[model samples]
Target: MDTVLKINNLYVGLKDMTIVKDFSLDIHKREIIGIVGESGCGKSTMLKSIVGLSDNNVSIQKGKIDFHGVSLRSMDQNQLRSIRGNKISFIFQKPDYTFDPVMKVKSQFFETVKFHTDGKANKKDCYKRSRELLEQLHFEAPDEVLESYPFELSGGMNQRIAVAMSMINEPELILADEPTSALDVSVQSQVVRTLMELRDKTGVAILMVSHNINVIASMADMVGVMYGGRMVEYGDAREVLQKSRHPYTKALLDAVPAMSQTMPESIEGAPPRFSEILQGCPFRERCPFSENKCETEPAIQGDASHWWLCHKQ
Candidate 1:
């Protein structure tokens, strides 16, 4: 598998406070990497930085973002814009805000195709392409969806359309920031399956950020557990979820509700404030297994494929 995107030692900050620290990962062709963490843990911020969409106050302080051997960190606005919606596409959490409620879906889809193609593709050409992608996403009547306004469709339908639009350019990578967070359980499954099918058919790699552990477990080939804007544990999805070594990872899994279990277990204490400089493990304060070694920053432990930040095995 070819490496589509790579990040090494990334540090992102909002004003003076660091939001993401020393984050690193490699995404390969047709692969799905899921990032799971609590709200405000920098999951959304990290995704925005990848596409050069960071807010006005936020900035990348260190590290490299390389796409297919090219450095994205050094690119200017024009350079980044050419690649953003073409080679890399972003699927925001809220479908309601992604499209114009007053505009017909077909017109909006055509506009994106035109912009990415430099106006080479006419409305007819855009319609053909959009219809094909929508059909693949399992819309029985693709024409109806194209003619309807965004306000006319259900949230799930709109989100699926958002997925289709993201694929209109045949981007090599898709950065999804909580794509299914706004939907109900059943709708969430549909959207998840649609994304998985899209990968299978188009060979597009995806970097999905979500707070739902179960959703990540259901679809991700690899998983990264984050806390305090840093990855506490990362490995093969099955390995990290079943044989997790980091206390934070264990706590996250335990917090998931199970059918046989009477009640879900919750992790004690809130996440640390980003303003306060972290000394040791970011999870030390809430960790039941914390020891003297945890007072000092723990070294990376475990093998290449599966690793964690901790003093204990």
Candidate 2:
């Protein structure tokens, strides 16, 4: 499989505080890499840095962000703009905020296609493409959706539209930041199924960041568990989810609600604060099996296919 996006030893920060530390991952063509972590774990920050959309206060301090063997971090604004919504697209958490309240759905789609094509694409052709994508996304009445305003549709409809728009350009990779987190249970399932089907049909790679482990378990080809702005464990989705080694990863999976009567186990202590530089394992404070060696930085353990940073293993 061809690698779509690569991040090596990435470090992102807000002024003096490093929020994303030594983060790295390779997303292959048509692969889904799901990153699961609690809030403030730098999942969104990492996604923003990949697209060069990090806030004014946040910046990539060091590391490489390569797309198709090309350096994305080295690209200037003009260069990045050409790839932003064309070769690479972003699906934000809030679909309502992504579109203009006043603009009709079809018009918004046209603007996206036109902006990426430098206003060379015909409106009629763009409409045809949009309708096709909406249909694939399971929109029964694609034409009605195109004619309606964003506010007129439900959150689920808007999110599906967001997914459709992201695929309209046929991007190589889609950086989805909590795409289904904002929707209810039923809608979440719909959006997840649509995205999975979209991947099957288009072969577009995806880097999805979410707090929901169950969602990740159902769709991701690879799973990455992050804490304190660092990847604590990563491996095949089944291996990481079922036979996870890292304490943090285990805690996360245990916390997920199941059908059994027993309550889910919760991890003690909160996630580490980035303002202060953390030494040793970030989860050492909360890990039940912590040893004296855990006071210092833990060495990388496990095989190439499945690995983690911990002293226990």
lDDT (tens digit, per residue) of candidate 2 on 145-183: 999999999999999999999888889999999999999
In model 2, the worst 10-residue window by lDDT is 258-267
Q: What residue runs in model 2 are displaced by over 4 Å at the alpha carbon?
A: 259-261
Q: How far is candidate 1 from the true structure (C-alpha RMSD, Å)?
A: 1.2
As a TM-score, model 1 comes out at 0.98
| Model 1 bad stretches (over 4 Å) | 259-262
**Cα RMSD, model 2:** 1.2
Model 1: pairs clashing at backbone N, Cα or C within 3 Å: none
